[model samples]
Target: MMDMQTQPVRSQSRPVVEHGFVTESMTDTCAIVANLEHCTNTAVALQSHYAQGFLSSRHKHGRGQISYCQSGMMLVMTDEGTIIVPPGHFIWIPPNMYHQAQAQDGMCMLSIYVENGLWPDLPGNSEVFHASDLFECLMQRMIEIEEKGAFSSSTFDAIVTLIRDEIGLASRLDMSMPMPRDRRLARICNAILREPTVLRGKDELARIGNVSHRTMTRLFQTELKMTYSEWCQQALILNALARLAAGDPVTTVAMDLGYVSPSAFSAMFRRRVGCSPKEFAKQY
Candidate 1:
């Protein structure tokens, strides 16, 4: 409502890697997010254009955030989990939750912000939602209208309402792998994640973490709430998602992740992602 040029906001972000791994690039948060904190509107949207390797530094919003990945993949980390925002997908971020994102090559993102009191009963936690065709069309319309910055309150409000309902109807993806904070488990996870190809047995991996195999198994169950084998499979699928999103060939990704053959890899990928590797690659 007031002059748009009068607001000043600062955001801090860092390069995010697969599975919520923090990369070398990070920027500190400003004294306060100078932008958009006092806007008169209840709903707002913004589009970000970035090259490869762009990392949104760690920050939290006073309002809930909906990040749509129009192209490329965005690794968004939150306390709940690290969500993979592949093309044609969106992630729901709860208000006041710290989050960060890093995009693959030529990433374009459109985000909608809903002030806390505007919508209630939205998901209290973060989750990746598969974008439906109708939802995408509506979002595109929202982008078009918001870009013009001129619309009746009721018209824009209807779009936001539709978006919220559509998102609720959508299903979540098997994208987040439970992370452990225990030092021993963290070490093991980091080592295996560093090179997904390393098919180390539990005994050997436990040795790397300086813990007994029995101890490691117990820790995985208690800390991550999954068996070691279950956790490893999920980790590989996440890594594969990143590679496939980056446009790697299915065969190459399969081999690099230690799959005996593309067929085997494809079977696992299909089970987890509900699509063949080739289909996932085409989006990016």
Candidate 2:
């Protein structure tokens, strides 16, 4: 993880009226974000801290957002799925996409919002990607410039270009679990999310969804583009990430996720995440 400390800068924008969207009631960070939407600048960067359990209610931005999780973990919930943003990772949200963000173990996030059409080739859907060291440095520079109110400076423009190019080159991580659109499959998937540790076979899950096993298999491939088992493993990995980020022991997370042993879980986690759970947890 990027081991850097940053002071949260309060938004200078005036208080916004509560419109059942983003309000002061839903974490101060969300209110600051609400104000940034109207800024005329091509891009705006803000640093905010959120307490554990802090949640930003469903909201949409007029501009695309790149939210870097500097500390703790964040889950960005969208209609399609949940994207896990662990420490040292960031999530890219396309313009006008409604989503909710929840913080785990408290969070310090640096968000950069860019105007629509500013980067015409940016991904249209949400994605989570690891933040490289160089990318982090550029982001830090951008934040510093934003703090100094130097949006029009040549240096600021150069930094913005570099940051955008860095983002374009960053590899997207498989830290997301896409949800199925069918109500029956969605119900089963939600149940699994609620209790990822519970063991169930394809037939059992299909029965729960009131669909035939073959139909359930077809739905998984058609909607999520993965097999049922693959989806389950992904759900387990995501849930394990959240628990592990919150300081849960590897053994405990593995057991909770129904892994027969910690080593088994660690091996699988390493295969998927490129690091052992212990190494990943050390960041937090």
Candidate 3:
């Protein structure tokens, strides 16, 4: 039996607060999140730093959140999919959505929490978007205000409005990978995620899932609405994004992902990501 459980396990530790910001070093983050959700402020901003390989236990917040990755990459995993937030990008998580986060190569992030019903158009689903220069500046201002405890400042209100408008107009990135519900298919997906460079054959993957090739194909298409090969290609692209953002050399990342040559990998990355690996790395 595969015995692979795909669902996120909830943490039972009590929550703790420290330094006016929630720190993973304290305790379970649930308590701080709960307190923030009920704060009277229209929006609250907090900064957090995580070391490489840091993973937060599965949790949810009552307020919608905008998480901006300032210096590294983050992977926000929800039941629907896993969204990659590289530097210069942010992910908006809807209120009360269950999710877990992982730091890729360590990260410095700023999280903005908006009270419920503040923006009627706030998306009900999580989305990743490239942060514009102006948006980035506005977020910095918000952080300054947060540090000063100036929620009632007229300047704070003005910046919040601009931030909301920016978010509404920002370009969304297709960086998420939808997960399958079936345990057999989930097992195959997990294996690919663990070692994306392997390039396993379809029959081999099917065997690993304890299914025939055709059944495996159908499961992917039916559950994820994407063909198995297409899904794998996306998986590879996401992995490449994280690696490149982590300051990995283009050639090194290419070789690690099993590409025959840097040129070949660069070509595919350009086609899917709309930029060469070198260009993408430079942006970070």
Task: TM-score each candidate.
Answer: 0.83, 0.83, 0.85
**Can you list the residue pairs that collide in candidate 1?**
8-34, 9-34, 9-35, 12-57, 13-56, 13-57, 14-56, 14-57
lDDT tens digits, residues 142-192, model 3?
A: 666546665455776787789999999898877878999999999999888
Candidate 3, pairs of clashing residues: none
| Backbone clashes under 3 angstroms, per model | 8, 0, 0
| TM match of model 2 to true structure | 0.83
How does candidate 1 fare on TM-score?
A: 0.83
- Residue 97 displacement (Å), model 2: 1.8
* Ordering by TM-score: 3, 1, 2
**Model 3 residue 139 distance off true place after TM-score fit, in angstroms:** 0.7
* lDDT at residue 210 of model 1 (Cα atoms): 99
> RMSD in Å for candidate 3, one decimal?
4.4
Give the C-alpha lDDT of model 1.
Answer: 0.72
Candidate 2, lDDT over the whole model: 0.77
- Sorted on lDDT, best first, the list reads 3, 2, 1
lDDT score, candidate 1, position 225: 86
Q: Assess each prediction's global lDDT (C-alpha) against the native.
A: 0.72, 0.77, 0.77
In candidate 3, stretches whose alpha carbon ends up further than 4 angstroms from where it belongs are 1-27, 148-152, 255-264
